[model samples]
Target: MSDQYLVRIEGKNTDIAVEETQSILDAALRANEWLPHSCTQGTCGTCKLKVLRGEVDHRQTPEYTLTVEERAEGLALGCMATPRSDLTVEPLGNVSDDGVPRHPLRDYEGTVVVLDDIAANTRRLVIELDTPMQFNAGQYAELIVPEHAGARQYSMANPPTETRRLEFHIKLTAGGLSTDGWIFRSMTLGERVSLRGPLGQFNLVAKQDEPAILIGGGTGLAPLKSIVQHALVEDLVPELFLYHGGRRREDLYDVEFFRDLEHRHPHFHYRPVLSEEQWEGATGLVTDVVVSDFPSCKGMSAFLCGPPAMVDAAVKALKRRRMAPRLIFREEFAITPATSTAPAVL
Candidate 1:
C-alpha cells in the first residue's frame, strides 16, 4: 500500500507521505513550510512542537533533553521525530504565516563596493546587490564563492534600509572555504561575486520600553550591530546593554562603532570585554561578564549571536539569572566544509 498521512496545523490540513526514514521537520521544510529550527539534529529545542495527534518515534538526539512532564505532554523535537501516522502539530512559535519563497536558495550577483580588514581576524566587505533584497536586521546571507562548492554564511553588520548595499564582517577560518581560499581574503573594490540570503529570525520587534541585552563574541558582533542600527533608525527606544567580547584588543574590531552609538543614545550602553587584553578594561568570557554585570536579568529580553560555545554559555548563564527562556533569541554561524556531511543537530 502507498504510504500517506494527513497532518493538521493551526486548523489547516495537509497530506504527508513518509517512506519510513524522513523526519517531520524535513518533510515540512520540503513542502515549503517554515518551522522554527536550528541544529537540525535535536541539540537545540528550537524545533520543539506540540504533537497534537498520532504517535511519533524520534531518533536518538544528543540533547532531546526534555523534562518528564514535557515528554508526557506529547512534545517532540520535529527534527528528530518521525510521524507514525496521521498527525496534528502545533509549531513552537509564530512562524511565517505564508510559505517561504519558492526558491529558498537565492542567487545574488553584486559588485564589491568596499573591502577592508576590520581586525586581524575579521574583514568587512560591502556588496552592492544586483537585485533589491529586503531582510530584517540581525539576519544573515550565504555567499557562493567562485570555484567553491559550499557557501559561507555571514550576518549583515548593517541594518536594512532603502539602500542596495549589504555589509558583512567575516572571520577568516584557517583553510576554510571562501575565507582561506582568497576570495574574501583577496577581494578588491568593485569586484563581482554571488550571494544569497536574508536568513535567520534574530531581528528586533517593536516594543515600548522593553529592557534588552545583547551578547556577542568575536565576529558575532555582526548581527548585534544590525539589530542596534535597526532600532535607531526605527526610533524604537529601548534600554540596551551590548556586551562584546574578544580575546585581545585587536579582536574587538568595532568597539568604536558601538561606543559612538552609546554616546548618541543615552539609553544604550556598550561594554567591551577583552579576555586576553593587557589593558585595564572589563575582562573575562563575554557571558561571564554579562552574568556578573547583570546578576538578575529577570525582566529583560536578550539577543545572542556568536560561536556555538558562546551561545550555549549565554543561554545557561541567562537561565541561571532567572531570565525568561522565551525572551532570549539567538543566531549561530555554522561554517563547515562540504566533505563532512554531518547532519546539523539543533
Candidate 2:
C-alpha cells in the first residue's frame, strides 16, 4: 500500500491525513475537524473548498455539480475531491473549538452478522467490526460496498457503548445501486466488508433537562433512535417528542417501541404521522405535526434527519416556533439523481 499524503488547511495550523481513496471531507471528518457540509456528497456543494496549492482529482464529483470555470479557478468540492498529492486547502468557515476530542480515524474489517426487516422497505444491518470504532450518538459511517467505486454513507443507529458492533438502517430507494444491486439480493451472512467512519457532527449536547424534539422521515429515524436511546440510558433528556412520517401505516414501524417508551417516561411523547393514511393520531407531513404540536419552539433543542426537503421544512417550522437556530441540529439524506453520483437519503 502507498503512503497517505499530508493535507494542510490553508488558513489554519491544522494538518490532516488524506488517502487517495478517501474524499477530503471524509478525511477532515475523521480528524474530528468540523468542515462545513450538508450531505457528504457532491450534490450539496456545502463542502466546496479552495485548493490553494496541490493537485486534486475532482473527477469524483459530478460534472454538473462543479463547473469547468470553477475547477480552473482552483476550486474543489471537498466531499468528492480526493487528493492526488500533498495539498493545501482552505475551509469555507470555522468550527467551534469547544467540542470533545475526536476519535482517531481507523479502518476496520467486518462481516455481515445480522439482517432483519424494520419497515416496509428498510432493513437493519448489523456488522461486527474488527476493532471498536468510537462515535458520537448521531454520527454516520460510510460502508465500503463490494461493487461500487464510491462508498455509501449510513448513520449508525447504535451508540458508542455498543462498540465494535455497527447497526445501520438500509433503506431501498428506487433505482438505488448498492441496496438493490447487492445488499438486498445477493449479500449473504459472513460476507466480508470494510467500513470507515463515525462521521458527521449532528449529535446530542449536555443539556440535562432540556426538551429534545426529534423529527424523522422515512429511514432517517436511525440516528435519532440512537440519540433517544442514549439519552434514555443516561437519563439526560426529560421531555422528547419524536415525530416520524411515512406515506402509509407500514412506513412508521417503531410505534410500539415509542409507545412503550412513553408508557415508562411521562415526559416522552411519540407522534408518528402518516401522509397518505388518515391516521387518528397525526396526519400530514412530519413537519406539519411538529408545527401543530409546538406552535412556539422556544428554549427547546431539535434534531432532524430525513430528505433535504423534509429537513428544510422542519427547520422552517421550528424557527417559526422560535427555536434558536443554533439549537436545531440536522443530518440530510440528500436525494441523488438517477445516476446516483451521490448517495441518496438513507
Best by lDDT: 2
Best by TM-score: 2
lDDT value, residue 101 of candidate 2 = 42
> What TM-score would every model get versus the actual structure?
0.74, 0.88
lDDT of 1 by residue, 1-346 (tens): 4355655665455665543455676566556466677545355578888998897766563333455577789888776676678888998866765332322324578999888888877888889988976777777776766665445667888787734789888888888757877655677888888876655557774654658899988889988888888787777656888898899888878778888888999888999898877687898888888988987989888999889889889999999998999888888765434212222211
lDDT of each: 0.73, 0.79
**Candidate 2 residues 1-346, lDDT tens each?**
5458789987668888887766787777767666776567677677888999889987557767778998999888887788899999987645546454466556678989998888888888999998888988888887776756556779988866998889888889666677887678778889888877766767874545568899988889989888888887777787888888899988777678889988987877888889999967788888887887887899898999988899999999899989999889889887564224542111
**Candidate 2 Cα lDDT to native:** 0.79
Off by over 4 Å in 1: 1-33, 38-105, 338-346
Model 2: residue 319 alpha-carbon error in angstroms: 2.0
Candidate 1 clashes between residue pairs 3 or more apart in a chain or in different chains: 39-345, 39-346, 40-346, 41-345, 41-346, 43-346, 44-346
TM match of model 1 to true structure: 0.74
